[model samples]
Target: VRLAMGARDLENNTVEVARRDTLTKETLSLDNIENTVADLLDDIQKNIFRKALNYRQEHTITVDTYEEFKEKLEEGGFILAHWDGTPETEERIKAETKATIRCIPLAGDTTPGVCMVTGKPSVQRVLFARAY
Candidate 1:
């Protein structure tokens, strides 16, 4: 409190006050378990995040053609491939390979190229996967 208020002497120590909002019902007794529960929740979130990161890193794949995409899909991973930027082409690839466009990254290779499935023009690659 003294440091926060820029006081240098103990006798002239400045006071500080703070407030925290709590969501527990008025009748529910916390009994000091709130900290324990918060710690457990933090640990659980960290574990889940690490598991997802590892899974994505282990399963990610990149392919340049429809044939390669099919082969990679059989192996089961996140596929990065050029898309023609049309729903029809996206649906056709999904119908043929059971892989769907999971996400289109905001940042990726911007060079124009032929689509992996339809040979149509595309501006960037998209992420494909067999979502669970």
Candidate 2:
């Protein structure tokens, strides 16, 4: 997600074609290997999500009620849930479900309510992650 012609100024050691992550002691090279690795992983993750969503689009059935939503959540994969972005509720949700805030999605609802798990107030919706 970053671009550069020469990143030697920001990087640690540059041995002609390699850079090192000073703190972690990891060595990496630029303009090719690192970029290629990142590109490959990004593509793979995107493809995986696309395939999963396509499968859901083709095979998964939709339901009409909150009860149905909850049932689907119990089975889990991806579920769109309403959330208010309070840190306590976020933490509580993660604690109870072993899921954490993943992404904010686009924009989330601003409605306020106590967290279903912790009874603490919350303010915005974000992904609650418990990945398989």
> What's each prediction's clash count?
0, 5
Candidate 2 lDDT, tens digit per residue, 1-132? 232334663474332322222212233454466666576557657877897779755543333333454466577555545554567655666665665655765654545554445444545434444666
Candidate 1: stretches off by over 4 Å: 1-31, 107-112
lDDT of 2 at 125: 38
Off by over 4 Å in 2: 1-49, 52-71, 107-124
Worst 10 residues of 1 by lDDT: 17-26
After superposing all C-alphas onto the true structure, candidate 1 shows an RMSD in angstroms of 12.3
Scored by lDDT, the top model is: 1
Best by TM-score, which number? 1
